[model samples]
Target: MSFDIVERSLNDGTPVELYTFTRSAQVFRYTSADEDVLYQGATFTAVPLSRPSFEQSQDPGRKPISLKASSGLGFVQQYIASPPTDSISLIIRRFHTEDNTTEAVISWMGRVTNVKFESNQVEIQCEPIFTSMKRPGLRRLYQTTCPHLLYGPECKFSKPTFQLDAAVNITGGTTLTAASIGGEADGFYTGGMVEWTNAGVIDKRFILTHTGSGITINLPFEGMVNGDSVRIFPGCDHVLSTCVDKFSNEVNYGGFPFIPTKNPFSGTPIF
Candidate 1:
């Protein structure tokens, strides 16, 4: 007797296509290359909402499903350690022999709301893409528009001129001193992206501000350790000056630098 479980395409010798998706960068959408990082062999479970006894007129809509899978060997550590922001999409395809054709079937397609990784397994909680549009609660007051540094419709700034990677030395306890990031230094790390290659996720972010060949940078709570592998991207304060100096795109500056700080509702300036 053959005991080997097989995942065969319904259409005779056809193949089944499986896809899992997650954002490569915290701010950017997934790219073709990001597809290379999707989790493998993820099992999906969708549960139907049970009807309430008291309500007869209302129909029990389809509820969100649960997807459980193992973090790929490359992404296990970061998936467990960092806060949840990674979004996931799952889709399955199978061929139908009777129809003489292949069709796509998706289990879950949405952002990851929660993730529990343990014992070499990862459990993910997700909602449909449309779920975010359903705002059942109150909205908050808008103070300012936070635009993406580059390539956002609001910002429209150009990409960075350079990319930097650094090795952390044991010297800087937690503050990330000058000596720790090699002999070379620059203040560009402030507002930059901090990514550790070994880390499966992105969480070592910071709004760095420093001195003496050191740029102050936002880092993880524990900061960097000896020989920690890290990469730094140039960050901007989003000012007219920085825009002109760094990216050379002052005309594309998003913020209103000339806007008065004093509240207009509170009357004119003291001067």
Candidate 2:
């Protein structure tokens, strides 16, 4: 029977919903059915997952959906402890059990926004893909300091060239000591970032302070241990001199450093 007829039939309908969450290279699939389901060559494990009725609005502003799942699940626990740096997306599909087929139609598609824990269950909130379009566009600012993000497209600087590779020699809570990275002057790496692998997952943290062979991170890396290799990148102070002396890329500097300090519109003595 066709999915349309099966879906509309009162007694002949058997339905299953599939939920797929993806973050970078990791993909987790789950099904609402009692048993595991295989659709499109991918296995969707049966899990204690449920979602309430969500409105299908015709207006541009859309409401978000919520997925409540057991926190006891391994995948749920991992995401709760340390959320991935990359954006995690969610795809929900419905399958008609009568024919074990779906028209490959996506019921809901969005990205994970927030996760909340209540008792033994986790509630994940997701916003529709078009919700981002409602956000206000960016407007450039007139400031003395560079407004462009480091290593961003406007900065026009390659991150790989400024990165340093080293292995952790000592671990102190949220701090790591790597003698190889100490060759650069103190504070050279402040405001930069560090990336390392932890328990087969790539973890990243911001550099809070850097002095000598010791560097403090903004967050304590979970399961980080000694001898773990890491890559550190240098940070920019966003000053005109630093742009010219350190990176030597003043051509791409986005700051107007020579702006007059005095109010030009006011009736005052000209410099």
Root-mean-square deviation (CA) per prediction: 9.8, 2.3
lDDT of each: 0.46, 0.82
**Candidate 1 pairs with clashing backbones:** 206-218, 208-216, 208-217, 209-216, 210-216
- State each candidate's clash count: 5, 0
* Residue 57 miss distance in model 1 (angstroms): 13
lDDT of 2 by residue, 70-182 (tens): 98865566566566665788888888656645454578888988888899899988898878788757767788889888899999999998889898865667788888778
Error of 2 at 47 (Å): 1.1
Give the lDDT of residue 190 in candidate 2. 91
Cα lDDT of model 1 by residue, 1-271, tens digit: 1111122433234222343445554222211221222222233222211111222324312245454454653332345445533354433332222223223344335665666775656665555566777885643223333344454665665434455565655334335443544443456555666555433555455545544444444435343476666665667776678777777777666555666667767865662
The alpha-carbon root-mean-square deviation between model 1 and the true structure, to one decimal in Å, is: 9.8
**Candidate 2 ranges with C-alpha deviation above 4 Å:** 59-61, 198-201, 265-271
Quick one: best TM-score, which candidate?
2
For residue 247, model 1's alpha carbon misses the true position, in angstroms, by 4.0
